[model samples]
Target: MTDTTHNEYTLTCRFSSFDTTVDVIFNNTVDTINDCQKKNYEGFISKQDYLVPEILQQVFEYYKKSYPDYYQGWSYGNQLTKQQIEENLPTPTNAMNLKKFIEPLSVYIADNKNCEEGTFGIYFDCTWDIKSSLGVVIKKWKVAEVGTGDIAFLF
Candidate 1:
């Protein structure tokens, strides 16, 4: 429906259902994504637009369960990992209690398509209490209508 042009990298999208505007990221170099898959992104957006909150909850749950080891790092100080220790970057704890720290930064959608459907991902800046960002693909967001899995599915 909305055939807006998007360049590679980041995009800004508005979800009218909730009056939300979020940045969108894309990696066109993904081999699984073709023109059709790209266009299918629009439909995925529409389908999951209303479930944003639920999707977020699911993202946190998935992170806790799927990557328990990763989530078990730090509660107050830097992590023991070589990179984290060398960088002296303070490790953060699970966002279960630090919900305020979970900042939704963007909505990433591929081009759009017909045959194969491509879903979108919600990228959140969970750095406040996590290692990297917490990216929720329609998969991580996990509504059957959109999908279920990790953020890697988005690209």
Candidate 2:
């Protein structure tokens, strides 16, 4: 059996006087565990390290509150119409922009991770299709870029 563990964290952020909740998960591989430990990072250093969630929750919260405008823009996700996009000037979620959005925050691991690899973000209540059998409208947001890595399409 492969040794792996799942660590989950819930981050709630307020923007434009609205609150959105994000679910963050870390599915750690053995290599990941070993790497974290070698770096002198605290915590159990397991796939589901307890410390990671605690730290990420606060960090994500700060990230959301600090960049209300960024979150506000994405709250609409892809539902924005061309008129709204042009009129309201909603920010598009992209690699270059995401790097700027998250640059102000201090998440060491995040600095080395990217949406396509390091971290996974799932946004709940992001769409209007509340009755869609898949549960509440599900939307996604990936970190896209970490450190100096190239950015990919946003979630």
Candidate 3:
């Protein structure tokens, strides 16, 4: 049997709010146990490393859920209050599912408006390694950029 003892993986997501850009970096070792484990665990762990984007998403969702009138049909130019933003932090389940590791470095941003022109950005950096028994490791990372006049796209 081919030995699959060592695998390493890394994923980096950087979002430029000022420029409205989302950048992703994924690195992994394939066909080897060590590489697979490393990559899988790294990607999973990295999810919890960044909080900005995750928090932003939660805040936006909370706004949509609570004060719908203020945000309805607004655009990217809208501004929100710090209090409102803080109130939007994700629930325990949501946070766990989004990022496997919890740390202080994560940051989130949200435009106060409720229109297509409004923009929400998230940035994530993470790393991990695979285990000996796991097979066919799959790691998926998704970032959704919401903005005014732009349909939501998952990348």
Candidate 4:
């Protein structure tokens, strides 16, 4: 029922040695001015790849300090300060490192099955090593949520 422009992004982190990878799927929707109603199956207006590292860092801080259950996946609803947002401004290097810009179409179509929906934060099921799993989530960011896990495994 929200009109907010739909935004979606996936943050994937990988650890080759452990054979583990984690992805954070973020989707946010709110009301918008346009009357043309469109349904957004996912959340987020767009995936901002440059912020991946910092966002993952934020998640790490949350998990460490809060000791979240992470059963169904923890939910975090915090607004980014103007300063914080500015600091996360996307750049060519960050996006390239994440491989988001390299394969835009593939990244956009990947399924969200690994991602668990949270109040505002995106969560993933961690059946493997917790520390290793979290390590993957800490790396990589994309400007949009469109892409697959192929690039993550490359790291």
Candidate 5:
């Protein structure tokens, strides 16, 4: 069941690779979730959901690449380096499923300042442990170079 008050709709969507149907919130300035936009979101989610594996793989890679600098001034100190993370983090022959690290939050369409219309964002809770994510979109995938502790990919 889905309902919308204002431009927000809680949709019962079944995204691929997800074992359970998560209730995702859809919000936008273009069109209401009751229209074709809802279908578009569904399709987008399905198409891009597969990126979870690779995304996870990239997070560790990024952490190992940047290392200590981004993780500086920590209570534990900046002693953690790329080599340290690489040594501990597993690099499986195949991409590992790290979707469980993120919890689907909401979908923002035509509302993102990052891009134009047809652009949307799916925010997640993958906080720095492949954990902090702005959302997964098919657009451009660039992990923060300045170390914002989150990957804000847009599509």
Candidate 6:
């Protein structure tokens, strides 16, 4: 059980075997605390509510459906440091083109079918290297993680 109180609202999460129950209390009278609680307790995860990219959310759902035992919770937390991002950036000479840059990678999990309990972590790494017509080179890299419906992007 975890309780968090803020000026705008108060949130309490109760963990259980069936599902997690989240209750919310609003400081303002106009807020519907019960409605908020209902929204939070729903079993399904929503990308719009969490501001997650649809592609990332799809990946999460895929893992959840394919490997229920391995999928614990979805998370969007920063697990990589700036230095790591810089190190993972692609070299200018091997950069991918624009069309290739936005293309999503095929989702890969260490254990596709057999997932253990606790927390399941998914890592995504992307690098873009662009070479201008003049031979100038630019490098970019991004690393992301998904766990328990949470997603984090490291650039």
Cα lDDT, model 1, residue 59: 55
| Candidates ranked, most accurate by TM-score first | 5, 1, 4, 2, 3, 6
Please give, for residues 22-109, the per-residue lDDT of candidate 3 as tens digits.
Answer: 3221212323333333343344345533534555455344333533433332323648554543333222244334333221222222
Model 5 ranges with Cα > 4 A deviation: 1-7, 29-31, 34-36, 58-61, 66-100, 111-118, 127-134, 140-155
lDDT of 5 by residue, 13-55 (tens): 6645655455555543333444445544655565555555655
Off by over 4 Å in 3: 1-38, 45-51, 66-139, 143-155
Superposed by TM-score, candidate 6 places the C-alpha of residue 107 at a distance from the truth, in angstroms, of 26
Clashes of each: 10, 1, 42, 26, 6, 14
Model 6 is weakest, by summed lDDT over 10 consecutive residues, at 132-141
Candidate 4 per-residue C-alpha lDDT over 20-58 given as tens digits, one digit per residue, 9 for 90 to 100: 453433333132311111111123223333344544444
TM-scores of the candidates in the order shown: 0.49, 0.22, 0.20, 0.23, 0.49, 0.19
Give the alpha-carbon lDDT of every model.
Answer: 0.49, 0.28, 0.29, 0.30, 0.46, 0.26
lDDT of 4 at 126: 28
> What lDDT is reached at residue 58 by model 1?
61
What is the alpha-carbon lDDT for the whole of candidate 3? 0.29
Instruction: In angstroms, give how far residue 155 of model 1 lies from its true place.
Output: 3.9
Residues 3-118, model 2: lDDT tens digits: 34533121222221122222222233333334432232222122223333333343344333434554455455578665554332324433232222221111222212432323
